[model samples]
Target chain A: MNEYNSLLINLSVFIGLLLIGYFVGGIVEKRHFKSILEREEKLLYFPVINLAPRRLVEIGEDLQIENCFFVSGLVVIGEDYFKRILGFLANFFGGRLLSHESLLDRARREAILRLKEKAISQGADMVVNLQLQYLSINKETDSQNANNSVEIMAYGTALKVK
Target chain B: MFITNIDYVPSLKIIEHYGLVSGSTVRAKHIGKDFLASLKNLVGGEIKGYTELLEEARDEAIDRMILQAEDFGANAIVNVRFSTASVAQGAAEIYVYGTALKVS
Candidate 1:
């Protein structure tokens, strides 16, 4: 009887996780993507470049650095329930982990966009010499793997052109 | 204060150069956030909680660097660089540095 009860509890917990991952995680991802699209459209005018500005007129017709400052954006992303399961299955078969591609992609895009937004708020014309750094921060766990974090940092210099 | 990642600013001229200044910070997410993140692993997607945590840490580090530059009487910071490392299982250390300069 005890063994049967334990089995039933485990099954219920598994189902609960699946339900949470499917419903809650889905809503979060969809909302995040929608917001990203809207923000990107609004920020289309801000020009973010990786090249250093050598001449004042290169960026704009009459541009000069009125106030220069450093800007940085960081995000640490993780996989969702569905993606984690897919990743596990893929690992067993030894193939490409395509499930994780979008995770990093979102992180990179969001970080860059945030950096540009910050520069624009500071009355900057453009952001230059952009740098990207990636890090992984995961905790060790006894029951499950503790390796599930991707950190992205986007940084640049903002030039307030006048 | 002006800050640029390159060795020189576009229109500003470097009048006096001070030594390098730097700032660093380490941060981690709360246990509640960690629990959510682990569940997220089941259906992989963007982790907003972790993103916010790291963003906050980076901003704090930059603020500290700016304070140091102010102490050096520098009007701008140039040649900025960033480095990060995993200090623990779920924590990161962010280090930012730049050269302080009096620009005109």
Candidate 2:
């Protein structure tokens, strides 16, 4: 009976250690993911400032299409929490992961809408730029793997159909 | 992505049959442990703070610039460009711009 009791105590301690280890791993993962988020936050501006400019202007306007438009966006995610859960069960550990849309996607949609508004302001029926870009930047690192994020962008021009 | 227009416009003029031009500007700042963590990237890793803050500011600045361009009765903004300045230590200034024009 005493032997069985000792085995049970050892089992319990092992379980405790495993759980603690998992949490510790999670904290580290969270730290890494946090920095990735920060990097994305800054990278997004490049589109607005560097990417948004440089539109292609045609020497001649196309009469068939009255409006041209472009759009873009970005999404970033950390990792799979399921993987973490599995690790914990395996006596290893896991961490919390984050998921988010690419800033580029957010930027693109907003930009095109602004263009549409511009068309309205000019009293033009449509537009004609019709171009955009999207990209992803991954910056996640861990004992197992590295993670990154994606970004999207949209741009276009508006013109009058008549 | 292939951009068909410029972000910065040196100037704009609207004439009869002349298409309208428009633009926007934005700026943002990120305050938290995020910035400090990014510094660790000085060793040649990704400095996320620079990317995150720049993205927010650029987007907002562009929106503002675009809205202002729309107010000017511009159909499109040509030759758009962006500029940056330090409004404060932890804050950044992002400016999105393009020429506003009007076409009849």
Write model 2 residue lDDT over B4-34, tens digit each, in one string: 2544221233352223433333333344534
Q: Per-residue CA lDDT of candidate 2, range A1-162, in tens?
A: 999999999988757654653564346445655654565564442222222222323334334433333332222222233332343354443343232222223344444444444445555554444454433333333333222223233344433343
Q: Which stretches of candidate 2 lie over 4 Å from their true place?
A: A1-162, B1-29, B33-36
**Cα deviation of A92 in candidate 2 (Å)?**
47
lDDT of 1 by residue, B16-100 (tens): 9989999989987689988887666665566778777777777788889999999989988889888888777667788889999
Question: What is every candidate's C-alpha DockQ against the true complex, given to 2 decimals?
Answer: 0.56, 0.06
- Judged by lDDT against the true structure, how good is candidate 2? 0.41
Q: Kindly report which residue stretches of model 1 are placed more than 4 angstroms away from their true locations once superposed.
A: A1-5, A55-63, A137-143, B32-49
TM-score of chain A of 1: 0.82
Q: If you assessed candidate 2 against the hidden native complex, which CAPRI class would it receive? A: incorrect
